[model samples]
Target: MGCVSRRTQCAPRDTRFPRSQLLQELARYTWPGNVRELRNIVERLLLLTGDAIDAATVRQVLPGRRPSTSGEAGSGTLANRVATFERDVVLQELAAHGHRVTETARALGLERSHLYKKCQQLGIDLKTERTQP
Candidate 1:
């Protein structure tokens, strides 16, 4: 067997698709479901698309999703904005993994303890806060 990086192992194998361009478009998306969402999209594309998976196909499949922009709707310092984004990502990941710290951390490529520290810094009370659907 050939050695494959974790990211490459996770992607679907479809030779007909413009893999690089598809990857670029996927990189632009803010996957709310994180790795799970990425896996689902790749699987869907493999099963649904024909000759090539283009940017238009990706957009059509992922409705209402837009590329992440630096200028969000808020008046805050750069640090504050970064923190807010981090907090949101953590919350979403936690919810996606049913608030399982280890799973969330692994999915995010972070250590479990580091994830806890980040959650604390973001004022996310995992014990008290319910996961959003």
Candidate 2:
């Protein structure tokens, strides 16, 4: 893909990229260059695609990677998808902070109690998490 500048010919249109599929595709990528590279690829995908951004568009933007399965997009409702994403992020942060609730909450920009509430809502058993080897 070419450099994604302001003049990238991307007219304002409603691009329907399903978050569940998009997130799955993004998570599957190795992203050797890290967050910056991921951001650039996303920008390119948005600027290059017409109307909608699907698995094919993602594959074109990110060659060599296997396209996500069709069923991934229909896995759940938008609220469920968002909850899954949030839960995954919370778990990752908790792991990074060695299961310290306070530290995980701080890193996630949430109050400690709020983090506990979030974990409860997400059905994450924090008691078990703390005891994991």
Collision count for each candidate, in order? 0, 0
lDDT for each residue of candidate 1 in 29-94, tens digit (9 for 90 to 100): 776775667766666665444334567657645635623434655567889878976776687667
| Deviation of model 1 at 45, angstroms | 15
lDDT for model 1, on a 0 to 1 scale? Answer: 0.66
- For every candidate, C-alpha RMSD to the true structure in Å: 11.3, 12.3
Give one digit per residue, the lDDT tens place, for model 2 in 3-119: 332323453545455656766666677767755687678776675443455665566467456333334754787898678757766876787689999988876778999999999
| Number of colliding residue pairs in model 2 | 0
Candidate 2 — which pairs collide? none
Residue range with the least summed lDDT across 10 consecutive positions in model 2: 1-10
Worst 10 residues of 1 by lDDT: 1-10
State the C-alpha lDDT per candidate. Answer: 0.66, 0.68
Show where candidate 2 strays beyond 4 Å: 1-74
